[model samples]
Target: MSQSKSGCKNAQAEFSRFAKPLVDEALAHAAQGEPSPDDFHKLRVALRRLRTLIWAWRPLLGRKFADLERAYLKRPAAAAGEARDWDIAISLLGDEQTKPDTERLQTARRDARARASSTLAAADLKHALREMLRRVNRELNTSPRRTPIKCLARERVRAARRALRKRMRRAQRANRGDYAPWHEVRKGAKRLRYLLEFFQPVLRRRESRRVKSLRRLQDRFGALNDAVATEHLLGQHREVFADAATADAALAALKRERKRRRRAARELLG
Candidate 1:
């Protein structure tokens, strides 16, 4: 058809080629009855990358298919996320100081892993994803949009960076102890980083410095997010601890860590 349509189709084909192997690998990893924590992590990351690409191309794909694809991807990603959170918690807490808490986290990890495995094994999920991809390709082929693939990629990257910068500024202006703003900033940084990664091939040399900065920003915010999640998880299961005093001490330490991380992130923003 037209030049823009051709560009869009080419871009879609490129993304599908890049994503298919990753999806297959994730599915294979999840098919195992007892996949390693790394397996789930890899699957979740693969899904995230795919979702980011879809989001960047949402305008061409339309709202209906984009929403459907997002929903399909979200289920397994969330399941994997639960398992991953527990894995991180278990690793960070260690076995020495909180034996009872450690045991409880281990049990939670097992349950999350089982849930993730079950979700991944569902045949409907695979069918839905396959159908969605088919629909996406069809739409890209027929759509009247004339925007070049590189133009679309650049627009998305710019938007992601602007959103992240705005959020970071708000977070920096907020009180240091305000966890909500920092968490929002963390989400923004994550979205921006993923978008940058998806557009890396299209905008390679120009994005090198931006990619490095985004990574550092994401890491700082991710550390803060993990600390906050740990504190909340420990609070939720406070009764499981052998000594309430120990639980309190652990939570206090997490809070201190969170504060330290928040400060570090803010310093970066400034």
Candidate 2:
């Protein structure tokens, strides 16, 4: 679908419209007892998109309000993040060898889920999100300066692309097996992907190829990162393990997977 030609005002309104329902949906899902992984994932994704929009329009919103909104979102996002990490760990490393770590993760996951539910249920959260949208609308209406959203989108996309390229270059130049460098590249890739998706309506047809390439890179990086995260989690909670050997085995398997994923990512980059 084509974006409205009107410009930033229309874009702000469109973003507000898209964001409200996602917040409502997230709140509703959180209200349910033991929200599913899918529900948490959806909530995380919704908030991410909202944050991305704010970031893309930082100049329009002004830094103070943008920082305020982002800070307000951090708690809920972290809650969801904690739950998500456990969810991913359990899903990927649930074999007998990882049973000890899995159990610990499950305990942590339950705590995270409870925190997420409580945070979502807070009346202040809904009120703040509503107020944020209202403030953004008000700011957009009152601001004297105006620019076409397409122009802004193009500028942001180019900037994101440049950032991704720089990160990729750094990753390529550094030790290929270094998880830290690759993880940084993954984050850049994710940001670029989000930007592209947000601006797809204004992008040209040929951009689809770029989108696909970014997606593939993101997937590869995500796989490697997930393994690294799981291994880290297991290592951090070693004292909680019922069977240290089991945890060790799981960590070994994760390291092997990380290597494989790193190889795949390198090949894709080339």
Candidate 3:
């Protein structure tokens, strides 16, 4: 089960050994026309875990398979995104606020649920899953997994550090008034954070500490994004507004919150 013994190619060997069974299991379930919600949920989980596993091993594999990985996995993740978004919205608003926005939120929740259901209904996902599993298994079968853990870990660390440096530079170059550039800077920071998190086991303690700081930066940006989404959602449900003054005030408050969060994100990241 452990591929760490395979000197230089530990990550690739480990990923294949660890993830291949999960992929195979998911594909087999899909092929059997499994209709249970729990089955689909398991499939989705398998896909996500495989994707994360590959991402952590990407440096060893190079960019050649990046497109293939995205093609097969990203679509399913997108199919699940709406539901996840609604879940996030609910979690953010808390139970107390759920009443006031129940009708509208319910509609969004239903749409997400529908997407999840429809995604499983589509045979392409099943076929795609099987096909991807076949390809990955084929590659692993032929390849010796020659890359050692040390080499793989070094590559991941180098790449993550490079990404962090690049994002910090971007933040330095971003203009105070240019929210777009700052947003991009935040995105870069997030990538570094994710990379570090994915490879945490291989990273040094100081590197992990840096990863935590970068994660805090990402969290700040995520909060700002949530504020923006909240503002947009509130505006879109204008028909539910009881009074003109209240609606106007709500809109204004939304905008103010977004503005404040953005500022806070920038300060925290800086």
Candidate 4:
């Protein structure tokens, strides 16, 4: 991987070059009726990976590609999310005692498990995902080649800074203390990290280290987001469980876990 004046451009090109074959093969396997679960899973992983690469390189290509890629990805990622949530919810059943509202939570978990299972079975999620992958591949191949890397980098940075400043000001108004400003700071940090990572040619290891620290901060926020989202999903299906006790317990456990996560984020930000 020789460095080019346009590392972001090269990175995007490499991602496209490698992703096409992987997606094509995965789609073929899924269409074969006897698609192995492993193969299907591989396809999903490939899509996620490619999407991540696109995210990291979004400064190079601008928001259009980002929007288009995300549009194709939303459904597939949602299907995967449902399956993932079910897996997590079901595991909670076995660990009910460790959680605060074990009895109630278990009930909720059971209900969630049943619903998730039914949804997974009825939905041709793999088929839809395969078709979506096919479409994405076609789109990528035909997408425009030129990327205004320098110009886009300047704009992306400016936009990121503006958004961060706006958010920080709001947070200050709300009196969120340190957490508010920290949250806004991390957003700016992430945009910088992504931009630098994509534009690797001019980026140095010292710069990479700084960006890595910012990424750690971003990760802390991401964890909080995940827990909140997951808890809501589990809570929404609480009525389906036969045991209210288990559901309540699970919800309580999730609350504590969420709190713990928030504290961790605070520590990192601080």
Candidate 5:
């Protein structure tokens, strides 16, 4: 084999080694008729990690193709996210769990879980995941553009870091009440963290050193997301409550939690 072909095969082999377990884990959970919280979480996480891997390879795969694949995966991602959000919101209710509101949320959670399970079971979704993997590996092995994997990894990881720094600046300048920029910051940070983790073997020692800080950043940002996302999810059901007063009380609780979590997230940035 030519040098490029040999290198490409090596890249394909290493990536498959890393990706196959995640695929199996996701597929195993998807096959379950009724998935537990942990199973659902695993399914969601696996899908996201796969998307991150796609992002890493987009340089070789072409951005448009990568974007399309990610978009196609979003339906299952959304369903799983909603289910997880319901669980988080319910957990946030804490001592209020005995109240009727908690029961209402639990009922919603059941529906969300069923939807996620249904999405996971969809023929198209299953085919899509498998096809994505097959196609990606095939391209890695056959594509004429034989970019060295190490060079690609370094370039993309550095670009990810730059993108994250830009997002952080935007978040810092954002108004206290406006979380959109901050949300972008959180996503950017997550993408960078994934890139670093996945490409660490090929990246410089300095790049690997950022993992600890990235973990801390992801934790703070994720806490903020939990609060904001829970509030957003619960807000949609404002009219579901039989009594307006109870609905107001439930929502008020979420607002307080959002406020508290946002503070911690903001403090971390400063």
Candidate 6:
């Protein structure tokens, strides 16, 4: 078949190959009655990767549909992240005077897990995921006019790279007390990393080599995020602690860690 007649690179087959395992992973973990903290994290990763994949194809796929698909994937990941965030808080609270807070975190984690499981297991999300894939296949198969596949991939990956660089600069210029800009840089780094990996086949050697640096950036940014998030989470529920002093101590430790991590992450931003 001519290029215009069948413009996509067997996108239906590629789409299934990339998306099915993630769907299966999500459903499998969702089915577990008592999914572990790791399970919730894995589910979040799968959902996040699926969202990134959709965004990577946006250059070829219509942006409106791609945006809608990404939004659809966001809910399950957010649900799963609630559980995962509690897990992060639990780990952050050291074995000092955190016994009380740890117990509360565990309770919150259990609740979040149940909610995540229910959200994932519900027929609506599953149906939506299936329907999204079907629509992707239909669009790819029937769209007569389309961008060249490799060109499309290159444009998306390069655009992600440019966006990441811009974010890093903005984050670097942010005040030491303002964490929001830094947090945005973290997200941008992740998005670029995922896009590069997804379109590696069409990437230049130097572009692919940048993954190592991106991984290091992620490590630093992730450490800072964990500490800051733990602090924020604990601060929000401080009143729940039976002893006010215990909450103070936990927050104190988290602040120290957050400062240290913030410094480390800032070094990377520069």
User: 83, model 1: CA deviation in Å?
Assistant: 1.1
Best by lDDT: 6
| Cα error, candidate 4, residue 258 (Å) | 1.4
lDDT, candidates in the order shown: 0.73, 0.74, 0.61, 0.55, 0.75, 0.77
In candidate 3, what are the lDDT values of residues 1-270, reduced to their tens digit? 232344434554556555667668667545544234445556666676667556556655556774568556867655655455555545544334223356756776676667765775674765666676566656644666566665666576677567656766676677765556556666566656655665555556577788777778877877777766666665676544445665566667657767888778768655
RMSD of each: 3.6, 2.8, 5.1, 6.4, 3.5, 3.5
What TM-score would each prediction reach against the true structure? 0.86, 0.85, 0.69, 0.57, 0.88, 0.89
Q: Which stretches of candidate 1 lie over 4 Å from their true place?
A: 1-13, 99-102, 175-177
Between candidates 3 and 6, the one scoring higher on TM-score is 6
The lDDT, on a scale of 0 to 1, for candidate 1 is 0.73
**What digit string (tens of lDDT, one per residue) describes model 2 on residues 118-223?**
7767735567777878887788777676667777778888888888888888888887556788888887887778888767777665665687888889899888
Best candidate, TM-score-wise? Answer: 6
The runs of at least 3 residues in candidate 5 whose Cα sits more than 4 Å from the true structure, single-residue gaps closed, are 1-13, 97-102, 239-242
Model 1 over residues 21-83: C-alpha lDDT tens digits?
Answer: 656766666666687988888878777777876777788788778877877788888888878
| Residue 64 displacement (Å), model 3 | 4.0
lDDT digits (tens) for residues 1-270 of candidate 6: 453433355443466667777788876776667888888888788888888888877755789988988888898888878778877887777666764454665677677788877877774656777787888777776767645555666777778878889989988888888888888888888888887776566556578888889989988998898898888877887854668888888788889999999889988876
lDDT of 4 at 137: 45
lDDT of 2: 0.74
lDDT of 5 by residue, 1-270 (tens): 443443344454556766777788778877777888888788888888888777877777779887887776666877778778777776765644223354665677788888877777774556677887888788777767556666777787888889888888888888888989878878888888888887766667788899888888888888888888877876787654546776677778778888888887777676
Off by over 4 Å in 4: 4-15, 18-49, 52-66, 90-94, 98-202, 239-242
Please estimate how well model 3 matches the true structure, expressed as its whole-model Cα lDDT.
0.61
